[model samples]
Target: MPIIYRIAASIFLLLTTIPFVNGQIFEHPKQQLINADSLRAEYDKAPYFGLYKDNYFIFGTSLNHKPSKENTNVKFQVSIQQKLTKSTLPGGTYLYLYYTQKVFWNVLEESLPMKDLNFNPGIGIAKPLFHKGRYIGKFSFQIEHESNGRDSIQSRSWNKISFGGNILLENNWLIHAKFWIPIVDGENNKDLLKYKGIFQIGTQFMTNDNRWKFGLLLVKRKDWKPNFNIIGEIKYRFSRKADWSIFLQYYNGYGEDLLNYKMFKSQLRAGIVITPPMFSDY
Candidate 1:
């Protein structure tokens, strides 16, 4: 079997086995486990300054299965936002800014030539949708730009309007969804929809102690012959007060980078995640 198939099967098996493991070992008192309301209150009280978002570094294989160049690579993402308007509610609106970059490093070669670089920057406003105790939710609308800082034939750039939301359920589960619409003409990226897709949806299953989180994300196009991308992530916090954690990530799909937006790829990575107390809390 192919490596991708084997990985997918392993993930499915692990997901199926997690409930049994949780039942056996995660039997702490219900009161001891942090609930959605308490978690929201804690995040609301946190000081809003300096790095107010999650940051991470991923090192993994490029896994470009096509007849193209493939190698090991590194990925980094940083996001920060500040409150623009204060409201009586616990979670309010804000101004947001985020940037993410991925670099392909030819580690097998002597000089480690970086094959490709993709940069994404987003800026806009965020607002609270609802904040009733354990059922808090927020949404953001942003004007985003992404590009591969190249010239001539290799240059790729586009601007988009994006909207996304984060909702914390009563059971401490989190649901995240986002959609983007390109603000460009056909001359720019006529085939972008074939690979980049229209929207993404994901869900997170949080442990009772708020120490461990498992997530699955799906990105797909809306056409009859659609393309899709899937990502699964697992993270474990070192301590209740720590701002960092161990992160394991897996991806199988296309559009890993702007340079290879139409290329299919798969990868597995392990790294450290700089996790703030709150994420996507407007």
Candidate 2:
């Protein structure tokens, strides 16, 4: 084995043998275990920042259109959330502030100009859902704004009110459903709902061993007619001790990019993803 691989293997072994988190032999299992002490350590810290969405960098090209500078590019997204208050507020909900940004880098084009930059920020509250004293899921509501940082005719911006939650279903399936009310007026995106969709619903399935995961998302456009955006992803973890995974994703439909929200496109992307312990972190 190469020197780097040998060193990583040694570290993984050592870390797994150390019972530093919740008396578990391997820290990876800690992603599924959370206790009072862990809660305090996470929520009571000086800076309570955690991952809000899956983060990744990908390089790919269009599957429907012929590959070219306009079709081949690199894409990336970074998302994070900060806990505004350590304790629950009047409604038994935790306050959170969030930010998520995405960039479409036209690496294949000459001069390598970026296609667009979508900036999203929001404030929200989350409440854990319980059924018959058993923890079932979580619900959240937020007021969010999304804009592509551009000047004049290139700029696209909108604000919306969103509410959604995750439910733990039978087996290894988890479902997430979110609905939004667009507040478009002077943003120059008055007809955004025709393509942006009124709501999004997705589900994920994970293997028992945690090595593989599959997911799908569907977005229904606002028009009374049939219009939808479909996305699917499958990811595999190379090692049990790591959070990173090899990711493959397919995007088909409109609204993939804020700058070209009306165009319909299809693409296949391959990349590496860092899976966050969003559920356990809380």
Candidate 3:
């Protein structure tokens, strides 16, 4: 079996065992359901685990720029966030630590060559926006570092401060936008701004029952003239209670990966998305 299959099997086994363990801890079936609901509610209210900003896993493929050859590859991302402070700040602010790793694999190659690995770690603060209800959503500010874990000529790294927000609309529409400010000019990634740009915006439309979702993301950069990248995605839940969902993604333009940041490419892929996007809950 392939390594990806093995990893997926392990994760599925762990997920299946969680319910059995929880059931053993509870004396009665009714008590188990009650406790489970209570725990879930508490988790929902916890910082860094809320909707939109929650952690997720993604596995997919990229067609690359070559279609009639072995240029297509496997892609995956694992992301997580942890709450750093239980106590709220003066204005009800919450602090969090976040990390995400994305990788591309040339599984078809003889040696199973891994193409690129992008590691991102950040600290962020989130606060309620507007009237504190879902009307205006939430605002977040973060400083992040991203690198390819390479050295010398192959090194690619940068630091960015970002301001972002999640907006939930009454019609089951969700919007997320983020603006980035590069902090340091790393020797290997000095021209990153010309390709990555200053900001990105995404919006999603979800079904009322939260079973189906579609979203689009736009990334822009202005060097001599404006350049743009667009990503489109659609997802379907297996069931209301399931933690996994099927996802289809399409991308056009540049900056899909740090190694090929400046290369414009178009691709279509499909995989699983661990959790629903933020502001998807109604």
Q: Model 1: which ten-residue window has the lowest total lDDT?
A: 19-28
Number of the predicted model whose TM-score against the real structure is largest: 2
The number of the candidate with the highest lDDT is: 2
Off by over 4 Å in 3: 1-64, 68-70, 130-136, 276-282
Tell me how far candidate 1 lies from the true structure as C-alpha RMSD in angstroms: 10.1
Against the hidden reference, what TM-scores do the models get? 0.73, 0.83, 0.78
Task: Encode model 2's per-residue lDDT on 72-124: one tens digit a residue.
Answer: 98887766677788666776678889887787888878878778889889999
- By TM-score, the candidates rank as 2, 3, 1
What are the runs in model 1 whose C-alpha is more than 4 Å off? 1-53, 62-69, 84-92, 133-135, 185-188, 280-282
Task: Give one clash count per candidate, in the order shown.
Answer: 0, 0, 1
By the TM-score metric, which is better: model 1 or model 3?
3
Any residue pairs clashing in model 1, and if so which?
Answer: none
**Candidate 3, 200: how far from true, in Å?**
0.9
- Judge candidate 2 at residue 131 and give its lDDT: 53
